[model samples]
Target: MKPDPSLAQRNLFLLHHFHNDVAKALHEHMREQRRRGEIPPYRVEPTPSGLPTLVKINESQRIVLHTRPSPLAPMQAIAQELSRQPPGATLIFSCGLGYLPCALAPLLNRMKVIVLETDYDILLEALRMNDWGAIMPSGNLLLLAGKNAMEEANILISKHGSLLKNGIRFFPGRILLDEETPTFTSLQTIARESQEIFNYRITSNLQVKKGSYAIVAGHAHKELLSVLCEEAGHVNMDARPVLRRPAVTQFVQTPEMWWESLGRPLPAKLLTFTNKAFLPSEWDKMKAFGIRRFLWCYDDPFRATVDDTFFHHLDRIYCFDPFLTKRLQKQSPIPVHFLPEATAFSEGAVGPPPWDIPSTLPVTFVGSTGLQRQDDRLPRLVSSRDPSYLTIRQFVLDALAKDERIHYDELMALPVEFPNFHKSARVVLLEDLATFVVRLHFLAALVNTPAKIFGDQAWLEPALVGDISRIYAGRNLDYLRQTPWVYQNSKININIFNVQCVNAPTVRIFDVMACGGFLLTEYRPFTEELFRIGVELDVFHSHEELREKVIYYLEQEEQRERIARAGQERVMREHRFRHRLPLIFAAE
Candidate 1:
């Protein structure tokens, strides 16, 4: 068999960008088939539209990849099918000849599309028939080829868990192989199960609104926002439906039931922390009920499977990270604004406990050590054995370890190129790994110092390497009540920003300042934009600087008091949750 230049180029491209094991397996299988003088299972055919199509040749039967003359005919059907479904991730059982993904590329802006093929031979034939360079690098399309449907499904869940959100839709390719029947069936089952779980979780958090504004968020945000809204004379309602009820029972009163329970006049607006608060259908119902939907993303949107489709339901989006805000503005039709996290405390909010100068800790840090559950996330990248991912990970870890001040945007925009390295979930994983490294590097220096770490037993792990157990405080702190007390009483509160939060100070900065505590925080590009560097809140550029600041501030009690007072004033005047409400509702 002669080596076709086009097919060889395509195979090489696949090997460069995709999983090496799958590409190598296809190469060896094709070589063995050629040696046996066996014809390829699929052959390319010219369509009347001057486009190539695929035709599968079995023992005595011919199966066309598409029945219509134009290769795009199947795409029309797919588009029509998609029009009826709600916005979310898509799961295709098979790739067929790769035309589906290729044709759907323009429509898949930020949407996650997973292609699972049971037969590697068919996948190999598809790779040989088409050029996947454009679609492959977009990072939205994932191709998984495995021995069986169950195996592929497991891989999909393990690697791309974010895509399994509530509204995921499953589709069998137009030309499904006999071997792919089980794949299609099993994947549909998985999708159904995922939807059920999502429905339960969303419905479990459903509340009936008493105020003109409804907030759907995690426990902390929900409590904070509820208080803020009510304090502003909104009389916010706590719409708890039922407590500790089974999911089976919760479904009896569907999300629509709660929405209808809001009575004839619905809330003036609905504010949700993330897209996970409601189902696609529920979003539609809310939109139909004339309730404006606004989303505030605390996490980096790029780190999750959220895409443009998810934004279609939202009227406005406020992102905590500036880098992501800019990225989302370009990709989403909705208005994307930069809104940093704010302190929940108001101007005259009372502290949980009276501030005691004598009992105050010298230095305190409140947050997770990111090291916990670190191993669970590494398996996906490690198992792939992709040198590109490994190289990028090591490069980032080394760069961050050398200089903790290296900006996340700099790492992301590094000039060094690797084929399709940035076009996968590995980049997100790299962000997490970089954060852990920077956090460990800075926190380890505080081992001998008087800095006491709170939250997560991971600090006591071997990574910190000291009598960290003595410094490790309780696992949890009441965010609304106790956290403010800790921040208020501490002499110097330390804040370490996650790398993924490129140019923004985290909620901890605002919280500590709101509590009138002197803060020594890691520097961020936008730190100056938010506060006076030395007057309001101090920032440290290195571990040595952090330690020096800790010692210096501990001794200069008057200086600490001045800075703490300034920070508290700045936060109460401009960085409270009440201040954010106007900016959020202004879009209306």
Candidate 2:
């Protein structure tokens, strides 16, 4: 009455199918056999550098893999089987389609596999269809959800109901069974009973439900990882390693060197919020010991600064201009401040008016000419198609091309010209723009000349105006002192623009007068409030008036020198950074 030995072996395999012992034994045996040279090794070892160590095989037939039925290595063996499969042949899976993907990964792309989803476990059925897309390349795999099982799988439809496609027919009634059994048990019992009695084939649709529940289709990778992890039953199966941290925190060298160069005048400390847009090598060292404010510049309006928890630790949020200031004020978790920009001042004054004709005739301007409308040289747009003239754009383009980081180069290139003035006469230059000259205090030194330029255009275009000059790509301040215009003219000038009425006197005018240059500038209503027109500085209304004043000033040498001297004295006395620096440093 004893059972046949072959039948007993088959029963044992069936009973131990979900236990995964067969898979573990097969994996260990294969490794040992390969080491002993009993079988050729088919797998590659991983590298220390995290790169894969691939196995080199010239022909597909050379591949041999250990495949045994186990819950732990289900996908591994299935994938191995897929590699050896021939195209267009269908491999019928007795288990749910879910198990087919991991086991047949290698064949998924090249050969056909038809999955028969028996009505076994609802969770297994749900899990199997999750990563069905990975099997898509193996276009040979078809999922058949048998007719009667379709209604039973409706529970899946309810949870992920929206993913259902059109034309699918539902089964009639639910299984009526003992309530004491586990859900999976009841499902399997029903499945085996139906297969034996009615010869029913159980399976459910593998197509993802569209529209409302379609999110599942896109999450195939995540679901596949989850399934692999669950099937492995590995409490500590970590495929990816944690990122390594350096043993030492590196410190930069520049700030310390700069501090040493600056001597004791270095404030108790310094802070700089910077962008890669500027040279960080010099700034990086300075940031190590002193306070470092890191403000990453970005043009994307939708960037979320709040998610950057690191920004809140900085003291002052330094930006290149007020526009950046305004943008940061809304989202920045720190106080924002503007840093004054630097310019090289040409050495010496234009000298006094001559006895006969003046030496420096018509003033010259330097800078680039761009699209007529989009340049600050031509401020007004003649047509609707014109874009605003902004020096920042030029600065960005030049910086990108040259990989240089010094700021205000575009402003340094302003076009300064004596439009209608006599060649021998003195003329004032104006350079000041709201967003362009973020800090205007540096303009204090250029005020000593008889004929100085004023207004936003002067600072915005100092090179052309003769206020500040530099040799191409030179970083030395001495380049400004070397320019010819520094010694040829009667005096320099200063003035603010109308757009800057809301703010105080622009910095260029202040710097000009402070530098002992002559001052001749615009006639703003606030000009008189700050200084006497004839005594401290000369102001003109129209272009014609500016021409006439230049001529008159050249004739009246003493009067021009007295006014220039007085303006320089007043600016140095009251308008220096020492007097107004406190208001700027206060916490807003």
Candidate 3:
């Protein structure tokens, strides 16, 4: 058949955004290959699919490479398969020219297509000859080819892994010759490997890394399991980070898809940050697959709005503070356990950096003041649209100023006038505003001391601090990995718990104590339960007391040393991650 100009013209027109990128990438790849005198074994030819493409020929050059008769049949097969695919779906194709991806664009309701071709030369030829002006944007249809195709394919799978509710629906384009031709065989192998990755993702089987215990973490709790993995126990801790809310919506929109992501049929439970109710409304889907959900929650109960029926979905709940535990127990029928922020103190715990390091530096606070004023939160607060919200927000903020404390049961008394007030918005707003006002008081009071603070620069602004260096210390390396080192070197590690959990100690106390560093923290009712007053650690309730204790500790080095030693001993004995997590998970 003579080359049809209309069809050829459509293929040649590049999606304007991808045109320069394709041309530049092709030119650079070809130039580099010429410099190395290594030409990619690919050439352009017209396929029976009625489009121009690069053919991976046998040495004899007689047969076209493919699993089926032609690429069009596979396109038809994929189209039919995709006709049933739900929205937020993704399709992965190997060895296909750009034509099919574009063809399927209109067929898909809102699906994304990823094309992984074997040769850049073919892609370069397609770009050179065809007018891809009719092609969809790079977002809807992606074309990846050439030497980096495999690497790009791997990344593509991971990036879109969370977006594929239907899992990875693969469309195979062609298969190169057998192993007798090493180059062709290797190229084909990579293509096959890419296909396998998609297959693993689309299926509903579990991929646990350890002996049935996989650590599933998200943004808030990624560091929660850090110490658990380093313990002296026989269990290996595997880190499996779940996607964020938006991306996850694409991959687990359906009940079956949700089950597949959790590695259905496997008895392993998932552990993630409590802040996100990843399956807020999709709990039944997970239960249908016999998958149990486990969560780690630490936020104040008022801020704990994961849908009213969220409790029925989870199998076990682990909370950071006793108060949070009590609130959760009242709302949930499942077992709710308390796990204080902990570190690994067993002999097998992580050792110090491989170098000579100082035992102490100066007085410093290692937390960010991430909260804003009442005005900043006003928009989200019910105060934005309703006048009644003012009374509720002020009441919550006042309670937080006095150190916020309210159980889940007490929340039912939230006026009830607005009907959706508590669940729809107020519960969350109260918790956030409470945190905001309290952080302001804590920082404002502590400014009298020369304790340097390390957090967001906003805390150092003129409104918050008059002397930047004395109050607002500079930032450090990545917070989690570098915090231990920062703690060990600080002379007196000061901690101020956020407003929400003022009645309970924050993780900073344990983190600093685990480093064998002296601690002078704001008073929490639970502090006495964990450490001795002025023995293992010092606590100050009032602003004047906080300043006085800083002066007293600076002068009494021996007492500070004793407290530091005692705190370390306590953590090593009873408060390590190895000790805490087992107890939480063990509670049947």
Candidate 4:
């Protein structure tokens, strides 16, 4: 088969040589071999500060050699050479290694192909021995096997010493091992065995040294030239030193984290407020631009735990409930914004109503109710549950029994003291929010729809079940039956806590609303601001009003639907995490 015209025209396939003593020695040897007629004659052409290349051929039949040539450059050269070659030109590969396909396959149809494999077993054995304890146990073995298999196949087509006569060279940078370095010797022995087993002879003088040029060899002139194009540069014989230095730190503290005691970036002027994740509406608009920071004032801080890192990193602080704001205002160093706690539309509005509920239903109340000793709650014994109540009552009872003071009925008949105290003076609240939750539950049951109270087992065990459950169910004349408002049947059921906030319209409302039920919620500032009293949500004062509202809303569907729909829109729009995330990340 004829070589490509351009390749044929080029004379002398010079296997690139590096600027090294070994390359000089090899060049002189090749020249002597040519003179002795042991090999084809070719002229040496030195590349400028580059690896030695096979250069100058007269008959276009001289071979050039390279070992482990750079894969990228060779592949490109092979592809280009194939493009110029005539159809049916025979292109023989002396080594059947994996790398050749990347360079040879694209030109396969343009030429005839032949492979020559050398001793295969030695290559496999060599690879295995060297790889037994290497860090990459699996990968090294696979690579070794692949190389051995390919080289073995090469031996079948080519003569035993054909490669040596054609040309054989090592990549200069490849470190050969010596006895002085046991580690190096180990590796060299492995390579030597692999070469012998694969039927490729290794030079007895092959040393554990660093300065060797990457050499590629081929049997044909065209193939030799193709490999020559891959030689990049001569091996560095002088040896270079590596310098190490510490890296400089690049840290930028965002403005939000200013008071963290670490220097922080200047705070941006924009401000944002949210209790939960950023709102989607706010996030979407700001995502395209650089957002500065956000402030999240979490309410129900006791019940609702949050990642403080989030608050610390946020630009400012935000609290929905006034009471929560007051408690945390001084405690937090960040500026706090008090957002009114609003009504959240429960699942009912988004999905189908859980039950057949009218706009106006029965009276309802929902809040926490729990027991504690009065001694647990006093100014002196703040941990006590109003010790004054018990202390005063016990004292009067003792005095009445001794006939030394007014009797129980006489004390009860006395006018109530400071009934308007709550209106006149500020009172520090200390009770757990769960107690309020139970109260709201019964209040809802009494007012709007038959109360569907939702809380954890703790709430049910003490407030709804056991003695109370038997009294309501078995007695047939329960607390509701004795009261003016009565729950028709098993309409009231307690639910577990879905979210944290007590004032916020929780999933209980959604459960009821989805069932087409109404929601009678606590009097939160947000409820009044976000939802109309007669339309979206019904606000309650005391347990009595809660009961009345529940009954009124139950009987009034027109009013209930109006408020439910409005509340649903508000919750889905304003309260959902998706809707709120943007506000969370918003620039402050």
Candidate 5:
């Protein structure tokens, strides 16, 4: 059936919008990597094809990609072959020689194609050398490259899955189709087994079964264990957690082997992801395997920027911080619901209370100050490399407001180097500035008090160079055992919300209360919404005021204990992990 002209026009409009969105999404992923210091030096390799490709300059010296050369045009036979495919979506593996795209143009009337080109150099080559503006407006094509290509491909598949079910027309480039190159090989293998991949995902998506299973995934093994523990007690379904990768491949490299690892062809009622994109982008490929439900939890959305691409096919998208919830809601159609982090007393794992434990440890603060090193500054990527605090703050705020693709004209004497800094660079830089200055101010206030601080090894100041070592009690606490112990043992447990979330109670609030700790936290608009102020816990509006309240609470031990009990009672009754269920899962 032919489409109406107006509908076709709207599709063109949506496609044009998608081009900008994906470009910005890919850009944000790169900036976020640099912000977190995860970027490694990239090596350039020439391909038989006209342009160059990228490879990781690694110690192992693995050959990254394989491709062959081709001229400005592919033979007529190649064009005919592409046109023969049914009218639907085509998933191309490598951009390869760039000829396939031009060849596929005549078939554009029926085909919506997505090219997942991993070679960054080739993508840049196509953008600079070829007329991309002509190709992009077709409302039927997309090209993704660079560090986040695979993940971005998953997002595309999820968004266009209905069209993709028609079939895959893969073309491998310099990263030749070989077993040695896992990524390229995985695609080739999955293509060979496309029917199985499709079947498993669709089967899993069927209505829930009584004895079937749901999988829970996380960024780390420890996090998987944490969520696994919590869900074990709360869920009606048979919930299972596979620790991050290798354990759960999501049908990328070996679908059959993964199903064997899963022990059975169980239907997936729910697939819970720990907001770090922990569930991988290839999630669409696993849809046939019974992944009917997607639950994504953003424990710290502001600390890292949210990519709505990750929410392409998600069932429920939740963020713990109120600030993030509001911002994400504005950008996404999916309800960006606000759900505070939860905690519960794990009496079994943590044996008995410490013997002869001090009634109280010195005034304690148990979070790592967000700043790590100096390169984290926005000026690091700027042409002038200026680290002026005020300049960086304004730049980041403006950049985030503009969708993390800052215009060159937004700053004074801005460098010509950065075309656009990702929105997350702004987020990360802005967050660092807030944390660095705020921690310093609070630390100065506690210098006279015997305040004991516990934080990451990144906590490099005050003690070594800043000359405030007297109160720097050293190192961070283990979130599982040591933190709970500190909360229960400390006379006045302190909380500092991250600068990104100025108006919400962070998970730390629930953690401290669950452990029955006497609480003194930073003030926020939503703080009172969760707990009655003055009666449950005291909040500080400024460093001086926090110091005064710390003294007052310490002297009034009986009153402090009373407030602590009240806070604990509130958390026990309303803020456990189970309480967050109704917000994310409607039936719950």
Candidate 6:
């Protein structure tokens, strides 16, 4: 009893086009059933109505899928009932031989059609009985089966919840099992909640009138940029003042309140520091409201899980790294540009060295260890499994464990064999590992020296080789206020670049220089291009070079002061937030 070649081809087509986690589960179930020589639970038989019908083969009783006199009557009745409802997405709880979905085929062009079947056996029988090439390939149909069907449905709702605003109709189909009743009820509850949320969103958007400009960022970024925009007298091309707003993380209540406070006037040009600030539907609403959306990728885009859905909503994208910018420009249609990060303006004018005998501390570093442990559940790898089973997280940890100092080129060259793993996740894992290795390698050298490290508790973890307790300062310094003081007070401030940032100097370099602190930074081609090495700022390419520079700079007070002063002058003249504001606000 070989599997039918036509059924195999149809299954391949459906799985390939409408594939998801649920589909994969269903596929594996079908494969296992075929291997075990178990027949599907349902059988097809011709009826007197001239249409084939499905019969559930239960030991207790046989269940007919359609009415006796006319198998098409129930499907026609369901279609007529659907016509009375408002235009919106359609969700069918089960598919019995594909009759219901096939009858609703003409409606697929107008709305999304989602078919959820709890039993994989029934779905297989339906696939084998009918040709779904017309409905499945339309890009509007989503067929979900298996135990986790509810989870997949929730994801689809989150992505396209706005469509439910008009109306949502549910068809229980010709057959509903006792186990599937709960799933249908849960979907109804989710759709109702989503509609309520969208209603609130619409009301809020209606209140705002598009006019001025606003900045959406994290608390620290929002505060820093708001102050800088005021101090710099930032204005748009029309000479209208660019108004600044507070940071918004949730898309619901806070934005509504803020909009009301400002007399409900929406900013014509909205600049957001991160895409995670708002949900995808909120982006669509803002676009509908005539707000031109802009995003600045201060960190690597991969670190944020940025995808095409987010990219398509943005009008312009600015990135810090040249290599990433070029890569994104090639992949996305959005106008991507390279814009280096700049430091906030110093509160007051920087003066000469404060200490007569250079500070007692030889050097100070204020940054994260980048070695924080992740709580993500790593996919377990069974022995003798295929390489494609390896997830990005597992692959990264294994590679780093073997050689913590693996070259970036070698790491990038390694194949990402798993097709299910996303491109962003791959880069993010690599970036995290690279940062951990780079920071640990350089910071390990300072364990012997009198360098004070200000960061989280990751440094004191037993995994690290050296006893860093003496140098590890508690938690963090306030980036806005305390960081500058520490920079200005220290004899030498060390700046280590994360490997993820290919050709861009970290903001630490600019901030240290702006505070008139002698910066001994990691050597990067962009750093050398921006400032004169050893003249404006000194750089080190290796651990030995770092230690040598730190020792040399501490011993020479005159040379340190000369270089620090020159760096501060350059930063104040060219690298402050004021200098970068124009480019950010410039029209395409």
**Maximum-lDDT candidate:** 6
lDDT of 6 by residue, 1-588 (tens): 123569647655565545534444565565456546788767677788877777788888788876657777788788777766666778888887777887787777666677877778777766776667677765666676786555656644543446576577888766665776787788888888877865666566354444456666542243575666564464332212222211112212223333322223566666667776666656777777777778888887866555688697789999998988887887887899988988884732345433232334578888765433221111112122335323433544454455433345555555654344355456655655556556666776787887988765555454442566567754456577567777887889998777667788778888999988889987778877899988899887777778887778788999998999999999988887678766766654
RMSD of each: 16.0, 30.6, 12.9, 33.4, 12.5, 15.0
Task: Please report, in order, the local distance difference test score of every candidate based on alpha carbons.
Answer: 0.65, 0.35, 0.55, 0.33, 0.56, 0.66
Where does the lowest 10-residue lDDT sum fall in candidate 4?
Answer: 243-252
Off by over 4 Å in 1: 1-211, 219-222, 234-255, 258-264, 347-358, 373-397, 400-428, 463-470
On residues 73-97, what C-alpha lDDT tens digit does candidate 2 reach at each position? 4445545644554443332323322
TM-score, per-candidate, Cα-based: 0.56, 0.30, 0.59, 0.32, 0.55, 0.55
Per-residue lDDT of 583 in model 5: 42
The TM-score measured for candidate 3 stands at: 0.59
Model 1 lDDT on a 0 to 1 scale: 0.65
Output the lDDT of residue 491, model 3. Answer: 72
Candidate 5 achieves a global lDDT of 0.56
Writing each residue's lDDT as its tens digit, candidate 1 over 1-588 gives 122578757655555445444554455455446546787677777778766667778789988875447766776678567656665677776776666766667656646676777666667666676677767665566566655434645534432323455366766655666775775677677666655654555445443343466555432243565566664443233222111111111222244443432333456677777675555676787777667889888878876666767798889999998888998888898788999888776532253454332356789989875533332224334336446445655665566557645556666664433344444555565565567556766776677888888775445545342455567763446577678778888889999877777888788988898888888999887888888999998998887888888878889999999999999998888887667776776568
Better of 1 and 4 by TM-score: 1
Regions of model 3 farther than 4 Å from truth: 1-108, 113-194, 197-211, 219-227, 232-246, 249-265, 275-290, 301-308, 344-360, 372-429, 445-448, 464-470
Best prediction by TM-score: 3
